[model samples]
Target: MLTFSFLLVIFLLTILLAVFDMMILDFSIWEALINLYFPEVATGRSFVYTGVFFGFVICIVGDFRLYKKKKLKKNHAERDGSP
Candidate 1:
């Protein structure tokens, strides 16, 4: 469970960082970030718009499931007489 949680956090953080990098690229802010991770593609040659949109959807679903899981765990603990 600990290892899984650590990897999940890293995955979420990486996606979030990529999203941030995309947002900044719109206004051309953070050239260093772009150069380091996301090198420039040719003009009008892109696929990231769809990817970012799906990222948001995935994040929403992930959050909802995470909340549900926590809530379920809390209920189980309470049923077991946890203080």
Candidate 2:
């Protein structure tokens, strides 16, 4: 759960940074995202975008695991009849 929370925070921070870049740097978020995932040529921006994407994937996986764990616990509690 801690890892999930930490990754979620990082993912959110990266999104905030991307928004800042879009507003202040006047760059297209769509372009950065497309190039990052489907790169024809390597650029420094691609690296940052990659980190953002990787963080997003990690957060999603972590959240899924946490959800499954919580669901399993709920099922067990219900089965045991311990309200």
Candidate 3:
């Protein structure tokens, strides 16, 4: 259940970033973000890509942090012989 929640968060963040880029930069709503990495792409596209990438990366890091915390709690509980 926690994992599903985290996945939903990441997905929502990705969509929000994409929509922000579209509204603020006039970028194509359906444009493939991967294309922004190419040197041939416009500078605006590069910026949009960077923003989206960072947004998703932050979500992934958060998910990892949550997983670590959950594991640590589980281990502590086991040591205490509870549940």
lDDT of every model, 2 decimals: 0.65, 0.73, 0.70
Index of the highest-lDDT prediction: 2
lDDT of 1 by residue, 1-83 (tens): 43355458867776677667668765343553455356665554356656755766677778778889999999999999965
What C-alpha lDDT, on a 0 to 100 scale, does residue 7 get in candidate 3? 66
lDDT of 1: 0.65
Model 2 lDDT per residue over 3-78, tens place: 5677678778767766776787676987655543466876577678788678777877878898999999999989
Query: On residues 1-83, what C-alpha lDDT tens digit does candidate 3 reach at each position?
Result: 44566568867876787777777777785662433334364757767768867866777778889889999999998999964
Model 3 clashing residue pairs (backbone): none
Runs in model 3 with CA error above 4 Å? 1-43
By lDDT, is 1 or 2 better?
2
Candidate 3 local distance difference test against the native: 0.70
- Candidate 1 has a TM-score of 0.44
TM-score of 3: 0.50
